[model samples]
Target: MKLTPLDAPGYEKVVYAEDAESGLKSIIAVHSTKLGPAAGGCRMFNYPDLETAKIDALRLSKGMTYKNAAASLPLGGGKSVIMADPNTDKSPELMQAFGRFVESFGGMYTTAEDVGISVEDIEEAAKFTSHAAGLNKGAFASGDPSPVTARGVFLSCLAALKHAFGRDQIEGKTVALQGLGHVGMYFAEHLHAAGAQLLVSDIDAHAVAEARQRFSARSVAPDDIYDVEADIFAPCAMGAILNADTIKRLKVKLVCGAANNQLADDAAGDALMERGIVYAPDYVVNGGGIISVSTEILKITDEKWVDRKIEQLAETTDKILTKAKALNASPHKVADQFVEEVLAN
Candidate 1:
């Protein structure tokens, strides 16, 4: 295994890892350490190129800085990416190799599960280094964060619903959800149990079929999700789904989901506000995973602490929406301002 360092202007540290034997190639970016050591997740995908992967690492790491602040976790922000087809390239040796690279950062960087990565895969990574979190087994393990993350997002959606429509109940509400991955699937289950009507879409046909069979969801094509006329639009998939085009096509009154970096650019938030759509900041709404992972980073064994923090995340979401409405500003701007104040303090 070989690790090559790279210069990233806004990041604390960036490295590219390569292990020929294990077929592992990954980039790890540490965005900040203002509050504490950097902690985030490792994402594995078949990115078109290394440049795109690096960009994702940088953006996601910075998003983590905000997410940790929103969750009130005593940690900074960092993220990593493995450039390969997660469905095909994943192997125990490759996971362990990635773990070795994470270990190289000492305590400055801690990893957990993210897109295309699972608790079982993280367990494999944990075998090589102690940096991996979200372990299903162990004294301090927080286990898989999917359910908790889904819970946070569902609560966030409720908060947005209250702010938009004067009601917080999901019962009888129609939600169009994009993506049915780990977090997405759990989110679907939450909405389903709450008696919400679902319109779902995903690149994976099997997952979409499962959601339809299990949740009684109506399936839409991936691109058509934006056009679905629903009360809420939940994007639990990849980032930047709400750019200029899709935001205009959206027919929902509230936008909330677990996807990170939902806005393609800062102006996207303003556009959503102009449309009268209550946009919950992605970093604020999708923070349960980090809150759970922080326990392993801080070695906190209390499960109740995690629950309390998740509840607080919902409160923060509500506050942000309230402040945004009062100021007649985008929630994205208010959310960033809050984090900026925390980091500045």
Candidate 2:
């Protein structure tokens, strides 16, 4: 494949790797390394085409840059995406090949887990590259970031509720939660314990069923999740669900969740604002996972430090929403501006 100019000109590196024998095709994007080596997760998907995969890689890597900066990590931003279904296409040979592909970066980009990739998969990658994180090898090795990420999202949602409803209470509120992944399940538990009603959906039937049993969550068809009438719409699934079409269908007052690149484009965020919907920027609200994994990478034993930072996510969310409301602008734009200011200094 020939090189095409990434619309994101600020990216430092973009790599495409293929091993036909192993059926491995992947893209790695390092958006920045100003603070330190770029670090993010490796995600697997069944993208329809290489261009689509490249676009997702570029967008997500850029989000990582902002996410790391906002989370105050000394690391920069990077991401990798394998263009194959993790369930059916993953293999030991493919994992090892992807590991070697990551090793080729020579520590410039370190990785953990993301959607469709797990800790076991990272262990396989770690065999070929020390750059892989979230391993169970040492005392400080972070195992899974989903719980921490869920906590951060929960905090941010409370912040959003405070901004939107003049109170920070979760009791008696109805939440339409899309996606029942690890983070989403934990988030539902948080809300359910707080007396919030949950309307849940996921591509994984087992996950959806589990959420229903665990939290008494009402199940909705995955595609129909957007139409649920609730106090908040939490998108824990993939990106771009808050576009023009879905924005019009939303019956919620606030939008908050763990999904990166939630807005299809900047305009989608603006559209949310025009419609009087409060949105918590995905990167800001979902920094806990990276914060959790970063502790392992930095070899820090201070759980207090991690807790303190995660707690501050509420304040961060409040600050962004307040500023956006004051300016009649999208929180997404406010978040980008905030990240730019952080990156600038």
RMSD of each: 0.8, 1.9
Flag clash pairs in model 2: none
Worst 10 residues of 2 by lDDT: 1-10
Badly placed stretches (over 4 Å) of model 2 are 1-8
Candidate lDDT scores, in order, read 0.93, 0.90
CA shift at 80, candidate 1, in angstroms? 0.4
TM-score of 2: 0.96
**What would the TM-scores of all predictions be?**
0.99, 0.96
Q: Provide the lDDT at 314 for model 1.
A: 88
lDDT of 1 by residue, 1-345 (tens): 888888799889999998999999999999999999999999999999889999999999999999998888889999999999988889999999998999999989999999999999999999988888999888888899988999999988888889989989899999999999999999999999999999999999999999999999999999999998999999899998798999999998999999999999999999999999999899998999998888888999776998898888889999999999999999999999999999999
